[model samples]
Every structure is written in structure tokens, then in C-alpha cells.
Target: MYPTHSLLEKIKLYSIILWPILVTQISYHAMNVIDTMMSGRAGTTDLAGVAVGSSLWAPILTGFNGILMAVTPIIGHLLGKGEKQEISRSVLQALYLSVVLAVVVYVAGVLFLPSILSLMQLEAEVAYIAKHYLIGLSIGLVPLFASNVLRFFFDAQGYTRITMVILLITLPISAFLNYLLIFGSFGFPRLGGIGAGYATGLTYWIIFGLSLLMTKRIPSIRAYRLFSHWIRPSLSAWKAQLALGLPMGLSIFFEASIFSFVTLLVSRMFTTDIIAAHQAALNFSSLLFMIPLSMSMALTIVVAYEMGAGRVKDAKQYSWMGIALSMLIITIASVFLYFLREPVAYLYTDHPDVVALAMSFFLFAIFYQLSDAAQATLQGVLRGYKDATVPFVIALISYWGIGIPSGYWLATQTNLGPFGFWIGIIIGLTSAAIGFWIRLYYINRRFSSLRS
Candidate 1:
């Protein structure tokens, strides 16, 4: 095909896209670490309040972002076919969708925050703090989604560096804001956990504004005249995006909420130390997990672009190359986690019980390495083909239908204690990986046969 890159060239191209994403994830993880450390230092109640509040809020934001994510591949495929004009139109439709989605999400999430908090049966002060925090965060959802629209446009134009730089630039400022507001430092009121929310919301709005300016001025974006014209919602285009977005959004919600559900439902039965240990293991694994996730995102970009350009064979090659690279990297990384579980556990907390509890899960965590990588990368492969419904269903079945009940059964019904819950995660991830890999194989075969 006219747009085909050689295998070696594909490798280089993949690296270019992957590294920024990797760096961006790493940097964002750093921000999370800082958030945790600072919040922990403030007080346990503050930390707990933030955690509870975040659990309720994060999935909603993630689900909404999933809807927005459809635009990335849409723009990618368009760019691949040299359809610059179409890119402008597609992105505008994305913008319209974001506006409507943002309004709906913000209104619903904020309006229902109190009732949800009450359902959690949290302490009065904790509930109050969490409610206010959720409100603060909700205030910024529209701007956040809008920035995401700009982000997709940039990514499709092959300039992820803008996003990476913007995020990296925001980290220090965000950290500083949190610090000042959290502890009443620099003469700020000590709003505690609520401060974290306000700081985050304000930062998001600021970033959103900056993104708008950047979108207007960036050479690549300016050419699209993305902001120069008004774009109303086209039912057909919105429907296409929704078709992909709803399943993807639900899939993300399913996967992310499972862990939250485990923490909320299963953790109550365990000690605080056990919960902390599980969290520590989760943090370490999540940081390490970013590599595969980045590779997946890169794979989606490459595959979508190649497929749209009618380089079906190249699309297949990209998919497999990405899967191979992810599995290989994760395998090596998992070995380190298994062997150095102690030190890794120690880095998070000095509590012996927490460390012991954390150590117990390293084996299972190691087991998750290949399965998690496979599932995540396969999801990306499917995303390139705009195939989300199947993966979403697979994740639903694996995580909820299988993993949740299994973990609960083992944790409560069996003698496995809290460790049983983690075992379920392993099972679920493995099942999903198997399903996704199978589906991806068929998707690849179909794409590879696309010669006219």
C-alpha cells in the first residue's frame, strides 16, 4: 500500500508514539504518588475521605473519557487517508458530543453525589468532605472533556508531544497547589481533602483553557481550523461515535469498577493493614502496568492509521508487533516484581503486617503480567478495528460475572481471607485476555484479507 512502513520502520514509528505516552503515564503516576503521600501526611481521615470520594468520581470520569476516546481513532483513520478536511469535520462532531456528554455527566454526577455518599454509610465528616470534593471535581468535567477533544486532535495529527509536555508542565503546579491548600500552608485555609478537590478542579479548568489556546495556535491544529468554525451535532456522526463510545465506556467502567468494588465490598471484611497492603501492591503493579497500557495506545494509533490507509497487512503486522513487545516487556518486569516483592512492598510502607500481606500477593500479581498485557493490547487492537462491544462484554463476564463472585467466594466462603479476592483478579484477567486474544486473531485475519 502507498502508506506502508517497513517492519523496521514500523518499529521506529511505534517507539516514537509509545515513548511519549510512556513518559506521560510515568509522570502522571508521579503526580498520583505525590497526591497519596501528601494526603496521607495530612491525616488518615483525609486520605480515606479522598479515596472514598475518588472511587465514586473516577469511574464516571473514566467512562466519560472513554466516550471521548472514540475520536482518537476516528481522527487517526482520517489522517491516514489524507482526509484533512474530513478530520476537521469529525473532530467538530467530537466537540459537539463532548459538550453534550460533559453537561450530562456533570449534572448527573454532581446531583447524585450526596445520595451515593450516603449509600456508602461513611462517617459524617468523611461524607461531608467527600461530597464537597466530588462537587469540586464535577465542576471541571466539561472543561476536562473539552481538553480531551483537543488532545485527540493533537494525537491524530501525530503530535502527542503537546499532551506530554502540557501534562508534565501541570504536575509541579498541581502538586504545589495541593500542598498549599491541603495543609493550610502559604496562608491558605486548611480545607483538608476538600482542598485537593478544589486544587484539582481549578487545575483542570486552567489546563482546559490553555488547551483551547494551544489548539488555536498550534500549526498542526490551526490547519484544521477546529476552533475557527461552529460544529453542530450530526446525529449520524454522533451515533457512530456513541456506538463505539458506549461499549468502550462501559468496558472501562466494568474493569475499573471491579477493583473499586473489591476494595469497597471485600475490604470491609479485612483489616486496615490488609487493605493497605493490597493498595500498596496495586500501586506498584499499576505503575508497572503503564508500560503495557502505553504500548496498547500506540498500537491502536498505528493499527487504525494503517487499516484506514488500506495497508491491511501492515495493520496486522503492527498489531502483532505491539502485542509481542508488550508481553516481552511485561514478562521481564514481572520477574523483577516477583523477586523484589519485599523491597517494593517496603518502599510504600514500613508496617510489617502490610508488607507481609503485600508479599503474599506478589505471586498472583506476577501471574497477572502476561494476561493483563495480552488483554490490554488486544483491546487496543480491537479499538483500531472499531471493535469494542465484544471486548466490553468479555471484560464484563470476566471481571464481574466471574472474577467478583469468585473472589468473594474465596475470600469469605473459603479460608483464603482477603487474598482470595486477588486470586479472582488473576482469573478474570486471564479469562479476558484469552477472549480478547481470540477475537483479535479473527479480527486480524479479516483485516489481513482486505486486498481488492
Candidate 2:
């Protein structure tokens, strides 16, 4: 039987794994914030272009990456069950899946993005920048997906700090590249907002190379033989991963797409300044989101590890611990947002009206912070139990079924205008929180019965 831990021991274990994951997560989200901030400094059109491009890119990337998130639990399960030999095979299959998915995403983005952007009625320069920015960013899809798989593989084995170190090393390089490419400094071409995309792409390559090196160089990880053997592509392995991953992917897609759709809707209804402001508020909120997001990720690792070891009680306790920690942290962040909303808004742009409007959006963002944290952490808990399909259905119903339509009706038909969408976001997230809580309760009972 697996050994159990006291609450304090669990807390210590969780924090050790969590802090690095948190930093890595914060660093990743900060790259997007950096892109928005630097692009804004370039000019209004550039900022709008990057914002629009990011809107189109975010959901797709998040959804696709969500599919790869399966690697964590799969590998964690193997490790927990003392099946170390199987880890390499799982990683290989995940790598194969990543390549296929990346290619599909790239080809689709290349072929269909222009047509979609055209329908948006964007300004000429904004359209041009947005289109090419996506093209540049798309170039990195292969490496980005590949590196993420490796990251999950490492994190699953409790090597969260390895990925964290890799990200920290690359984060500043991404910023410098953005500076040089965006402003045409140091003899680089002045691609403006488009450069941000290219810089991001190049950074992906660097990150991938470093990740491969880590797999080989790290003594403990090297034992897994991730690189030493070539495993042929296997259809059965692919199906096994997709069985668990697809619903997880779709659930994430539904949630992320709602925000992207909201941005698109706002673009159709408002001016470039308004879109930029909306993006600014969205970007900063996304940054704060990384805190809970990281907690959720850690929860997935911890919970899955416990479950794989047949320690259901420990997994349950850890899940609650993660949720409580997330709530406490988000409460502090919301207060910070409330007191410094204007300054935070101004960080994105100098335009007085945009800053004022963004500050207003921040208030709505603050309202949803608690719900967002609760739902995100709860989803992470559910993922630990390998319960994804129902969350996908719930996300579909709450986000598209309830959230978007209500937001649209309020935005166009009522007095709330753009603000109505934010209200919709709050409503949707609150619904998700409640839904996930109920689901978790039932799942816990089911697991408990099985244990008895």
C-alpha cells in the first residue's frame, strides 16, 4: 500500500512543486502581456492588429495545448503505479500526436484565417498586421506543441523546476527579441506588431531545443530513455490518449473561445481604441489568471499522482487544499486590481479614453475573479479523476449555450452595450463553478463507494 502524508507534509510537498510551476505559468502568460504592451508602444494600429491576431490565436493555441495536457496525468499515473518502463512510450506517442495536431492547426490557420479576418471589416493596416502576425506565429506551432509535451512529461515526474528553469531562461530572450524585431533596433527589420509574432515563433524553437536537451542531460529524466529509442507510430496509443484528451481539449476550447468570440463581437461593435482597451483588460486579467491556473495545474499533478497510487483520501484532501489556496490568493489579487485598476489599464496604453474604458472593464473582471478561480481549480480537480466528458458538456452549455447568447442580447438589445458581454462572462463562469462543484461532489461519492 502507498504511504499517506499528514496535512503539513502534503502542504510542503505541494508548495515545492507549486512555486516553480507558478513561476513558469506566470512567465508564459507574461510573454503575451509583453507582446500587448510592446505592440501598444509601437502605435495604435499596431496594438489593434496584435490584439486582433492574439484573439484569433489564443483560443486555438489553448484548445490544442489542452489536448496535450493529457500527457501529465498519463505519465503521472505510470510513475505512481511503478511502471517506469512505460513512460517513454507514452511520451513518444504524445509527441506523435502533437506533431499531427500542430500541422493541422497550422494548415487550417494559413488557409482559413485570411477569409475570417476579411469578414471582420478591420482597418487596412490592422488587417495586414493581424494576418501576417498570425503567419509568423504559426511558424512555431511544431516546436511549441512538441515542447509542451516534454514539459508535461517532466512535470508529471515531479520535475516542475526543470520546465520552470527553461521558461525563465527563455522569457527575457523573448522580450529582447520583441524589442529588436518590433522597433527595428540592432539592425533587425522593423516589422512592428508583426515582429512580435516572429519573435514568439523563434522563441518556441529555442524552448524546444532546450527541452530536448533537458530530457537527455538531466540524470534522473535521462533514465526514462525518452530519446534513446525510436518508437514507431501506433494507432492504439493515439486512441487511448484521445479518449481522455479530446473532451479535455474541447472543454478548454469552449471556455477560451468564448473570450475570443467576445473580443470579435466587441470589434464588430466598437472602435479600434475600444478593442485595444478590451484587449488590455483581458490581457492583464489573463496574467492574474495564471496564479489559479498554475494551482490547477499543480492540482492535476498532485491529484493524479495520488489517484494512481490508490490514495483516494489523499487526493481528495489535496484537491480541497488547492482550491482553498487558490481562493485566498485570488482574493488578494482582486483587491489589488480594484485599488490599482487605472494604473494597470494605463500600462497598456497612453490614450486617456482607452485607459478610462479599460479601468471600467477591470471592475467587471474583478467581479468574476472568484468564480474563475473556483471553476478553474475545480476543473483541475476533476481532471485528476480523469472526468472530462461531463465538463465538456457543461462548458458547452454554460459558455456557448448560456453565456454568449445572453451577452450578445444584452450588448445589442439592451443598455449594457459592450459591458453586457463582461456580465455574460461573469454569469457563465459562475454557472461553471456551480456545475463543477456539483459534479465533483457526485464523483467524490462514486469514488468513495468504490473504495468502500
Candidate 3:
């Protein structure tokens, strides 16, 4: 039994731990929502264009983020084990690696944007709009990469508040800029959807700059040179990180791709109203999903630190605590959203048909949050253990093998329509949650045995 004072202390500590993460998550999702709202004003075609373009971009971009995720645990472990110099070396190397990877991905995305959009079977006008947005957005990849590296570094050092500060500054600036640019306010040109993309790109640079400045202020971070003799990438280290990162990257790709793919798949079966409704519901779900997502990030840091310090019991306990907290928070959020689904759907658009469709999908979303929170937490636990491949395999099998096929069958082969597509998401997420939890249990057992 815990003492009341001790329990209060733990609550305070956890709140401090979660606050920055929560802020960052909220800011990021808010930016996305603002972008969507701005784009919707341009017309449904514009909205659809951004949606499809975003789907194509997320898997590729987030795959890179997955690589950065690999770095966090490594840095967290090193920080915990008091390998300050090694942490510095790894971070510098990771920064360089991230820049290189971002350049490659950006160039590839720009060059292929037209081709990819063309292949997506979008309306011609929508394709044109999406391509323009993608072109402007692609240029900011390096800055985005840099920002992620800084975020991971701070998170690893248990200084999550820096990200919150940077995001607080960036989010409003980005939204205001987006408003000005998208609507021709304040003497800014109305580039419409393209303007939103430009605003986002500029915001990425701002975040990168702010993160760099804050990073320089940290005594632990400032002790090492940004580019020193130890900054070169070790082939062995790269391989080790890749070995751990690739699976995680693929897992993220699989999961993000499923939603993205479903968006496209639904478009094939339904009209733009249905597609718009789906997007609105998805956007809301994604935003709310950030709560669990932040919890996952915090869990990774805490669990990895404990594990690295050889406190196996503490690590296990921390992971479980994080999961419980995430579930409770998400459950409440889901309930709130469920009760307010129609009003929430109206926030995206005024179209009655779209609102109705969105409200219908929200019912499915309510189910998704529980499973999604569970899967995300377990994935974080696996990250702490540096075990990625099994989860990746599980995501692929569940998402592709079960989720997509069922969605295709239900939406096309059956009569469930757009709701059927959401059912597919429910199935995929639930399966992933169960699979990941089972894998975590076995891994935890093995880890405990070894420790004993």
C-alpha cells in the first residue's frame, strides 16, 4: 500500500512528466486541425486534395520519425547509465543522419508528388491542388527532421517542457500565418490550400530554430560540441539503430498507411460528402489520439531510463502505470466525444450530409480509442525493451491481413457503406492491441526471468 503523501508525490511527478508531452501533442494536432479547417473553406475538392496528399506523405515522413524514435531510447538509456559523452556522440551522429535522410525523402517526395497524386484516382482539380500543397510542404522536411531530433534529445534527457514551450510559440504563429495566407488576410496572398502548406513549412523552420536555441541552453547538452571528432556515424551503431528502428518504422508505416489507405478506399465507394465525413471523423480521432500518443512517448523515456539503470522492476511498473493512466484518460475523452459527436462533426463543416456521416463514424471511433491506447502503450513498452520486429510483424498482419480485407469486403462487397469502412479500422486496431499486449506480456516475462 502506498502512503497518501507518496501517492500525491507520484501524481505530481507524473503530471510534470506528462504536461510537456501533452502540450506538444495538442499543439501538433491543433495545427493539423487548423490546416484542415482552412482547407475546407477552399471547397471539398481542396479538402480532399489535402487529405489524399497527406496520406501519401505521412507514411514516408513518419517512417523517418520512426528512425528518430529509435534514437530516443538509445539516448535515454545512455543518459540513465551516465554515458554523457556517448549520448552526445550518438545525438550528433543522429542529427547528421536525420538531415541526410530528410533530404533524400524530401527530394523523392517532390519529384514524385505529381506521379503519386495522379495514381491516386483523385479528381483532376483535386489532384492539382494536392500536388501544389505537396510541393510547398516538401521543402520543409529538413527542418522538420531537425526539430524531431531536438525533441527526441530533450525527451531523452527528461526535459519534455522545452518542446511544449517551442510548440506554444510555434502553434499560434503557424495558425495565424495559415489564416493570413489561406484567406488573404493582413495583405498576405491567398494561396488557399497551398498557403496552408507554406505556413506549415515555415512553422517547421521556426520550431527547428527554437529547438536549437533551447538545446544550446542546456548545460548537459552544451558540454559537447555539435560536430566533434566523435560525430561520425559508426557503421555498427547505424546498423544497431536500424535493426531496432526499421521494424518500428515499418510498424508505424503499416498503421498510418491503414488509415490513409482507408481514406482512399472509402473515396472509391462513396461520394465526396462521405469522404469528407470520413476525413472529419479521422481528423478528430487523430487529434484525440494524441493523448495516448504522448503517454507512449513518456512511457518510452521512463521505461528505457529505468531499464538502462538496471531497475527492471521499476521499468515494468512504470510501463504499467503509463498504460493505466493513458487508458483512463482516453476512455474519458472518447466518452466526451461520443456525447458530442454531432457538434464535434459540425466544427469541421456545415454540410448536413457530411455531419451525419461524420457522426455515424464517430460511433466507431469511440471503440477505436480504447484499442488504440492499449496498442500505443504496448508499443512504447516494446520500444523500451528495444524489441521492434515482433510488433512490426503483428501490425502488418493485423492491419493488412485482417483490417483491409475486411474493410474492402464490407464497404464494397457488402452494404454497410462508410460505416463498414470504419468497422475495418475498429477490427485492425483491436487486433493490434491484443497482439501487442500478448507480445509485451511474453517479453516482460522473459525480461523478469533474466533479471531474477
Candidate 4:
């Protein structure tokens, strides 16, 4: 049986493990909220422009983020095993690979933005604004990918606080930049929605620079990269990274694309007001999700380290501890969101219809957080074990087979509308959580028995 601790001890441990993650997640989303608010002030068209453009932009960026996610577990295992040289080499390779990937995606977005926007069937004004925003946002892809590579490297080293600090500074800077650029303040010309894009692009470079500076200070990282041996990429090492990364990357793409597809479907059925409201609720939920996300990340490092150290039992304990903490944090956040629903909605928009629609979606958001926390934590645990492919399959089935169909049925066939759509999300999340947890349990048991 797992060991139990005092409630106070549990809370303290959870705080130590989770607070940095919570802060990073909140700060990241706070930047988005600030962007939405600033652009909303520009005009309704500006708000819709950002929303639609982001729908396309975020998935592509997140796909690259998936590649970096593959780096963390490998680095964590290397760190756990005291293979410092290997860790350094992995970091360098990840950075090089990420830059290449970013270039490919950025060029694709820039070259295809006009055509992509046209395919979305958006109004001419909305499409024009979205295309302009994409052009500017595309410039930051390399920096964003660089930042993520650094984040995974540091996280594997158990220095998550570094990311929290970087985000704290970056967010305020981004917000300030947005204010000046979007409004033509500080003698800056008002570029409107495109200005918001520029602020976001600049912030990515700032984050990348700060992360690189911090990495340079670490003796291990410095030694590994400065040595001539580290400059060459191992074909085997690259293959290993790709083997571990591609499935996980595809899994992320699958999940994100499902949401993107749903957003498009909803746009087909509703007005811009409804789409904006859906975006607000989705953004808020995604922010809240960072709490669990951060914990899951922490758990992945802890579990991977423990496993690498040949402490299988300890690894299992860490997984349970992380999951318990994630669920509790999400539950508390859900209650807060429930009571403050109206105020939360107001933060995004003042339109009565949008506000009402956002509130309705919040109802589903509250419930979904529990399942999301569970699944994400388990997924993190799985990453620690190098069990990526199975989880990918489970996610595909849950999101596509169950979640999407249920959502369409309820939203269009029934009278639930946007609320119906979120109901599908809730179902998908629950299925994923249960399936992932079961998989983790069995895998751990088998590994433990094999070791014995």
C-alpha cells in the first residue's frame, strides 16, 4: 500500500511541487487574456480576428511544443542515471531539431495563411484581419520553439522555478508591449490587431533569450555544449529522439486538431459572438489546466528519476502523489470559478450574449477540470516510463470516437448548442482519464514484478 502523510504535510509537498507550475500556467494564459482584452478594445472585428487566427496558429505551435515534450523524459532519465554528458548532448540536439521544425511550420503558416483563412469560410473582414495577424505571429515561431526546448531541459534538471520566473517577467513585458503597440501609445503607431501579433512575437524572443542565458550559467550545460564532441549530432541519438517524439507529437496534434475542428464546426452553426464566447471559456479552462499540467510535468521528472535510480516503488508513489495533488488543486480551482463565474466572464467581454454563452460553457468547464487533471497527470507518469505509443492510441479514440460524435449530436441534434459541445469534451476527458490511469497501473505492476 502507498504511504499516507498528514494533511499538512501533503499540502506542503503539493505546494512545493505544484506552485511553480501553477504560476507558469497562469502567467502564460494571463498573457493571452491580456491580448484578448486589448484587442477587444480595438473593436469586435479585432477580437474575432485574434480568435480565429489563434485557432490556426496555436495548433501549429503546440505541435512543435509536442516535439520538445519528447525531450523531457529522455533528459530526465539521463539526469537520473547521472549521465551528464548525454544530457548535454540531448539538449543540443533538441535545440537544433526544434529550430528546424519551427522554420518548416513558420514558413508553412506564412505562405498558406491567406489560403487557410479563405478555407475557414470566415467573413472577408475577419479573414483579412486574421491573415494579417498570422503574418506577424509567424515571425516568432523559432523563438517560441527555442523557449520550449529550454523549458524541457530545465524541467528535466528539476529547476521548474526557472520557467515560472521567466513567464512572470515575460507576461508583464508582453502586456505592456501590447498596450503601447495596439493603442499607438508611447509614440507607437496603432497597428490594431496586427500590433497584438507583434507583441506576442517579441515576447517569444525575450523568453528564448532569457532561457538561453540561464542555461549558460549551468556548468553541466556549458561544459556539454562548449566541448567539440557535443557539436556533432549522433544519428542514433536523433533517431531515438524522433522515435520517442513523433508519436507523442502526433498525439498532441490529434487532440488539438479535434478542438480546432470543433471550433470550426461551431462557427459554421453560430455567430461570431458565440464563437468568441466559446474561445473565452476554452481559454479560461486551458489556463486552469496548467495547474494540473505543471504538476504532471513535475511528476514526470520525479517518476523518471526514481525509475532510473532503480527505485520502482518510489516511482509508483510519486505518480499517486502527483495525481492526488492535481485532482485537489483542480477541484479547488473549479469551485472558485463556479462562484466567480460572472466576474470571470466579464474579464473577457461585456456583451450580454457572449457573457451568457461563456457562463454556460463554464458549467462544463468546472466538471471537465477534474477529468483533465487526472488524465494529464497519468499521461505525465506514462512519459516517465517511456510509454508513449499506447497513450497516443487511447487519446485518439477518446477524443475522436467518443468526444467529437457526442458533442455534435448534443449540439446540433439536441438543443444544447455550445454547452452541448462542452459536454462532449467532458465525456472525452473522463474516458481518457480512466483509460490512462488503468494503463499506468498495469504497466507499473508489470515492471515492478519483472524487477522482483
Candidate 5:
């Protein structure tokens, strides 16, 4: 067990982990911003294509990545228990699993993406860009998946700075490549928005290479010898990870896919300008979302470590602290979003109509920030406790069972038009926040009683 610490000490420790994580999360997500902004500059059709492609891609990526996230808590628990010997084996198995998942996602995308896009009934060029953008992205899935497991391994050990440094190194390279390929700058062929996908895919390979180097060369990490010994694929390990990870992944998928589904629904009903505007606002909102998301990720690590050591009280403290902090930061962020909505809208497109619609969407985005932060951070706290199944159920019911249907009805049936979908999102997130709060309360009581 670890020694007890004052709140100030805990804050310091948390900050050490959180700030790097926040930077990395923001920088990594900035690639999406780069994609949106650069492609927006190309043309509205390009912007809309990327947006729809992203709508199709983000949920799949998040779901699989979320599955890979089980590695973080698994390593966190092992560290808390001082089981250093098992770290390399667990991570290696996760890598093997990543390869398999990558192949599966790639195959599925190749087979089904065209059909999916066709169903959306997008314009011809828009359809081409969207299809090729995903195909380009699919090329990097293997590295992307593998590096994510490596990232989780590092994060679980409280080495977020390593990933942060790597991302810092990669972000500019990605942006430069995006510029070259998207606009045909410096003689690179003009791929427009489709080039963004290729740039992102190439960046993933670079990240994987750097991540492996860090694993092999870093003195402290080298002690784990993650590569010195290769553990053959083991069914039991796969089962263990899947058991914990599948629910967590599905929970994330449920939440993320709701937005994607909304985009798809919007694509069906809205004009290109409207779709561009919606994508622009949604993209900005997603960037802001990384703030709470980073907090939630940190909570998962710290809370898992505390819970693993049987310090339920400390776990509770960290959980509440992170949740409270997330709410506070998002509140401040919402204020900025309100004041700067117009400039922010202009960043995505110069088109007056798109900018106007995007600004309006920002209000709804602002309205949901608190509930979103609360629910997201609470999910992190529960994951730390190794409690995922119930949250998955809650997310599904809230997002699909309630959120989507409500949004669709409002958007289609009411005079609210596009705004109706935003309201549905508010309802869904608020419901999730309320449901997760009740679940955490019960979970806390159970763990506290056990501790007593």
C-alpha cells in the first residue's frame, strides 16, 4: 500500500500526470482540427466530406481505442499491487490483440464503407473524398492500434510526459504534411481533404516507431523489457482483456456514435452549408471536450491505483476532486466559447451562412458542457474501480435508446430544425450524468462498506 498524503500533495501528483495528458490529448486532437480547418479552406464539399468520413470513422476508432484502454487500468492495478513482472506480458498480449483488431477494422471498412456512404446520398465529389479519406486512414490502423496500447502502458505507469513529448514532435510534422498534400503545396499532389487522412495515417506510423523506441531505450521503461521477451498469443489473456475492455469500449462507442449518427442524420436532411457548419461547431466542441476527457483519463489512472491498494477513501477523494475540477474548467471554457463563438466559427469556414449556423450551434454546445463533463469524469472514476458493465448499459440507454430517437424526432418533426438535434444531445448527456451519479454512489457505498 502507498503512504497517505495531504490534499495538496495529491493535487501536485495529479497535476504531474494531468497536464502532460491534457497537452497530449489536445495536440493529438488538433490533428482533427487541422483536418477540418485545412479541408475547410479547400472547399465546402471537402469540409463536408471530411466531416462525414469522420462521423463514420470516429466511433470505430474510439470503440477500439477504448478497448485498448483496458491496458491502462490493468497496468495501473498491477503497479499498485507491485506486480512489475507481469507488465511486459500484459502489454505484449495487448499488442497482439491490437493487430487483430486493426485487421478486423480495416477489412470491415474496406468492405462496407462504400455502401455506407452510398446510403448517405452525398454529392459525387463529396462521396469520393469521404470514401478515399477513410481508405487512407485505414492504412494506418495497425500502427495506430499498437501505439495506443503502448501509450496506455506508459500512462498507467504515470509516464504521460513521454507520450506528450512524442506527440509534440509529431503534431507539426502532421500539419506540414497536411498542408503539402491537401493544397498541393510545394509540388505535392492536391488530394484535398483526402490528404488529411493520409497525413494522419502516416503520422500514426511515426508515432508507433517513436513509441517503440521509447519503450526500448528509456531506462526506466526498459526495465519492463517489453520487447526482450515475446509472449506467444494466449487465449486466456485475450479473454481477460476482452471481458474488461469490451464493456468499456462499447460504452465509449455508444457515447461517440451518437454524435456520428447525428452527423449522418444531418447529412440526410441538411444542405452542404448546413452540414459544414454543423461539422465545424461539432469539431470545436470536440476539441473543448478534450479538457474534461483528459481529466477523466487521469482519474482512471489515479483512482485505479488508489483502489488497487485498497485505499477506498483516497480513491473517493480523487474521484470527487477530478469531477469537481472538470466541471470548473468546462464552466470557464463554456464562457470563452460563448464570447468567442463567431471567431471560432470563422476558423472553420469563411462562408457567412456556415459561420452563422455554426455560431448558433455553439450555444447548444455550451449548454451541454457541464453535464458532459460530469458524466465523462464519472465514467473515469467508475473505470478506476473496475466497474464498466453497468455504465455501458446506461450509455446505451441514454444515447441510443433515448438520445438518438429524441434528437431525430425533434429535428424531423419540430420546427426547431437543426437545433432540435442539439436539444436531444442535451437530454442524452444530462440523463447520462444523472445515471452515472447514481451508479457511482452505489459503487462508492459498496467499496466503503467492504473497506470497513
Candidate 6:
């Protein structure tokens, strides 16, 4: 199907693509994990603030990031069709979209955020810290979105290694800044939970600015003429992107909203220690999650290229390859998490109560990680096919219709408490994973080629 390449050859191709993605995910996610750890050190209240704030921020971040995803698949499809020149317009349009979304998100976040937090009924001090944290974070949304736009442009051409290098290089600096600011290290004013927020915004803006400069200075990037001309976004492009991306945005929103809700409610229903534990356990789970997420993105690019080139069977091969690879890797990672949860939890915080609580909750992550891996891979495959709408609805139903409500019910009504919330997570992810795979199956059967 793919010019008779050996299984080893396929693995080689995938490996070339997958390694950078894996490394990048680690670095990218490390920023948040670092924040949680440092905030934990600052105090339990600070840690709870960061946790609750991140929950709200995750949905905003993930949803906007998903919407801006129009650029990557577009670039991949163009590359496959040998239409490299048109990529500049797509880049320009995506930038426009990114900036506009950034402004809207910032405004909406600032205006309605207080009311939302008020409803959560968090303690006065924690709420104050979270409110300020969102403010600092809101300022950086523009550059953050822009940086991701640049990432999509380069990553489409298999130049993912640069972004990976950038993030890895940024990771340590991010940690250093968090330490300096969170605790007033080196004579700096201690900002507590809000310090991580300020550090994050500044670091992200710096990354975005430097990345843009690199695109101009780097010969490889200059070849695309991405900055050669300014082009206004056309109606058709807007329609096309929104049609493809809105569902993606909503889908991501629904899934993240569940966790966000749980984090907020837990803060109200339990002590700051439980919130800290939730934050720490979540950070650990997210660290491992990057592996499957990276694999999924890489597969999306490969599958899009193959499908666009009319290599339908090759696309399918890569699809299965992606799924199998993720499952195997996650299975091993789960085993490691199973045995090492205590040490890992200890790594986040010295507080015995928080450590124990986080470790207990981590067992649920081990069980659900498999489902999460499958769902992530499927989401990517569907994106490659540009068939996001159906999966979007499925995710909404799975996560919201079933996941959040049930988790809330369990948390409120049952003795399982925090563990009950986790049980809901497992059910949601498992259902979404199965639903996504089934959607892909229908698409494959209905259309001979992936690009329908």
C-alpha cells in the first residue's frame, strides 16, 4: 500500500516524527507541572489557588488551541498537494484568528471571571489569588496563541524539533522564574499563587516574540515567505476554518469543563489539602499524558499527508500504527505509575496529607490513562480526516451529558467523595474513546478516501 515498505520502515518514519513530539510534550506540559510543584511549596492556599485557577484556564486554553488547529491540517494538506505558496495566506489567516480569539478570550475572561469564581464560593483569599492569576494569564493569551500558530506552521513540515528545542530550553527558565517569584527568592516580592501566573505570561510572551523573530532570521523558515505579504482573511477561509474548528473548540471545551468543575467544587466541598492533592495528582497524570498526545499529533500529520496524496491505504496503516503505539506505551507508563505513585506524589509536595491523598487518587489515573490515550489518538486521526464535528458532539455528550453530571452526583451523594469524582472520569473517557473510534469506522466505511 505504501510502496511496499517494511514494517521496520514504517516504524522508522513514525519514529522520526514521534520522538520530537514526545520530547516537546514533556517540556510543554512541564511548565504547568512546575507551577503546581512550586505553588505547593509556597503554601497550601497558594497551591489551591493555582489548582482552581488552572481548571478554569484549561478549558479556555484547550478550546482556543483546538480552534486554531485549522492551520496545521491545512498546511499538511497543502504540502501533500504541493501547494506550498498558498500556505502564507493560511498562516496570515490563522494569525488573524489567533489574535482576535485572544482579545475575545481575554475580554470575556476578565469580565465574567469574577462572577464565575463568586459562584464557586471559594474562600476569600484563594478566590482573590485565583482572580489575579487569571488576570496575569489573560494578558499573555495573545502571544500564547500566536506561538502555537507558529508551531503549527513549522510542525506541518516535520520541523517539530525546533519547537521542541525551544520549549525544552524554556522549561528550566520557567522553573527558575517560578521559584524566584513565588517565594520572593533573590529579593523579589513574593506574589504567592499569582507569581506563577505572572511568570507564565511573561515567559510565553518571550517565547512568542523570539519564535517570530526566528522565523524571519532562519533560512528554512524564510523559504516559506510566510512574512512576505499581509493578506486579509477571506470569507471562504473564515467559513472553512470555523466550520472545521468550532466543533473542535466546543469538543475540547466540554471535556475540560468537567475537570474544571470538579476542581472548583472540590475546593468548596473539601479542604485546601484536597485541592492541593487534586492539583498534584493532575499534574502527574498530565505529565504522562503528553506521550500519547504527542503520538497523536504526529500521526495526524502523517495521516493527513498520506490521505491528501491519495494514499488511502497508507493512511489507514499509519492510523492503526498510531493507535497500537499509544496503547503499548501507555500500558507500560501505567505500570510505572502504579508502583511509583508514592514517590512521584512526594516529589510534588512535602505535605504528608497532600502526598497521601494524591497517591490514592493516582490509582484512578492509572486505570483511565489507557482510555485517555485511545481517545487522544482517535481525536488526532479524526482531525487528520478533517471530520471533527461528529466526534465533537460525541465528546460533549460523553464528557458533559454523562461525565460531569455523574461525577457531581457521585461526589455529592456518595461516600466515595473525591474517588467518586475519579470514577466519573473513567466512565467519561472510556465512553468518548469508544465513540471516537466508532465514528472513524463509519467514516472509513462510508468514504473510500479519507478526505470526504
Candidate 1: give the clashing pairs: none
Cand. 4 TM to true fold: 0.93
Candidate 4 regions exceeding 4 Å error are 1-17, 218-230
Question: CA lDDT, every prediction?
Answer: 0.78, 0.91, 0.82, 0.79, 0.92, 0.85
lDDT tens readout by residue for model 1, 129-217: 77776776667777889888887777765677777888888888888988988889989999887888887877788778878888777
Q: Per-residue lDDT for 138 in model 5?
A: 82
lDDT score for residue 199 of model 1: 77
TM-score of structure candidate 2: 0.98
- Cα lDDT of candidate 1 equals 0.78
Tell me how far the alpha carbon of residue 268 in candidate 4 is from the true structure, in angstroms, after superposition: 2.3
Candidate 4: deviation at residue 390, Å? 0.5
- On lDDT, the stronger of 4 and 6 is 6
RMSD of each predicted structure: 2.4, 1.2, 2.5, 2.9, 1.0, 2.0
Model 5 weakest 10-residue run by lDDT:
1-10
Best candidate according to lDDT = 5
lDDT of 4: 0.79
Which pairs, if any, clash in model 4?
A: none
lDDT of 5 by residue, 68-151 (tens): 999988988998888888889999999999999999998898788878998999889989999999988887999999999999
lDDT by residue (1-452, candidate 2, tens digit) is 12347999888888888899999999988889999999999998899999999999999998989899999888878877999889899999999999999999988987899899989988899999999889889888999999999999988877899989999999999999999999999898999999999999999999999999998899988888887889899999999999889999998888889899999888878999889999999999989999999999999998989988989999999999999999999999999999999999889899999999999999999988898999999999999888899998998998898888888888889999899999999888888888999999999999999989
Using lDDT as the yardstick, the better of models 5 and 6 is 5
Q: Write the per-residue lDDT of candidate 4 for residues 312-416, one digit (tens) a residue.
A: 777777788788878987899999999998898888887888899889888888998898889888988998888888888998898888988998899988878
The C-alpha local distance difference test score for the whole of candidate 5 amounts to 0.92
Evaluate residue 153 in candidate 1 and report its C-alpha lDDT on the 0 to 100 scale. Answer: 74
lDDT of 3: 0.82
